[model samples]
Target: MSAILPPSQRLWWKEPVERIEIVWIAIAFVWCLILTFMMPYWHVFGKQNLSNEAYRTTPQAFAAKAQAVVDKWKVREVNGVPVVKPPAGADIYLVGRLWQWWPAYELKKGESYRLHLSSMDWQHGFSLQPVNINTQVLPGYEMVITVTPNKAGEYTIVCNEYCGIGHHSMLGKIYVVD
Candidate 1:
């Protein structure tokens, strides 16, 4: 019975790995270390720094804060939509709900603003057209999207995610002015 078993199987645990096996094992171990090192480096010096930072608040609380901003800086109305031009280098709030984005911003051509985005009722999408800035809008969580308007035009904000029957009507606007 002992002779019937192959030499490879008989002393499997005692057998030394081949040269190729050792090389492959070393490569895998090195690769794991590289990946482990990359994560922290990327987090510290990556464009995705905004993804890690978030503000937690209730929908009602965030809405009130957003409303205050709207009331404060609302300049005029363009076709029933209040055009809000936030001060350059200031924080702006945008509330998303079923079928609308509140207080469309009228930004300067070459100014940056930190946009605080949150959903009022359900999960929504924040898609800035033409410039093509897209982000996820979650309920009870405030996401800050830093944007610098390079062009002077009216950009449409469309909801890329399906929330409800009125999803198609979930249209918003951001007008970058000179």
Candidate 2:
């Protein structure tokens, strides 16, 4: 007889479910309930949730804002990229374009600043290492996050999305001073 065929014995449907099967079913239902509640519970009390502070904006306008910060606070240039040192509590902007994170930032330890991020040409991922802050950088929209660095060191901002052939070269930096 084929495995797909029903059992030749009669009255198979009349048998009661085994005790072990009932216990397994109960366990699975309880697990499903726990999994369903965990997401909302974590969002209410999680320390590392993604910020929901984003807005629709044109790429031109966003670029203007980023350029204003670069022009005002640019202290130096490294590898042809501007390194801006905006004051604590001020706004800072980072732009992702073609293959780079433009105009790196210099921040002071324990001071908070509003950080704005946007993409100029394509979608990108903003991943700040050592601090573990990751956000999506989408074209024509701005993502804002408040950051307060607690340690004094150099941090790296790497693109976690594949943009193009030069995706691997798209790296940025942030310097935190005590």
lDDT (Cα atoms) of all candidates against the true structure: 0.86, 0.89
Q: Give stretches of model 1 more than 4 Å off.
A: 1-51
Residue 105 of candidate 1: its Cα lDDT?
82
lDDT of 2: 0.89
**16-121, model 2: which lDDT tens digit per residue?**
7799999999999999999999988988986455568898888899889999999999998878989999999998889998888988988999998999999998
Task: Show how many residue pairs clash in every candidate, following the order shown.
Answer: 0, 0
Clashing pairs in 2: none
Return the TM-score for each candidate structure.
Answer: 0.73, 0.81
Candidate 2: segments with Cα more than 4 A from true spot = 1-3, 6-16
Candidate 1, residues 38-124, lDDT tens digits: the string is 988988886444555589988899889888888989998866878887899888889899978987889998888888999988899
TM-score winner among the candidates? 2
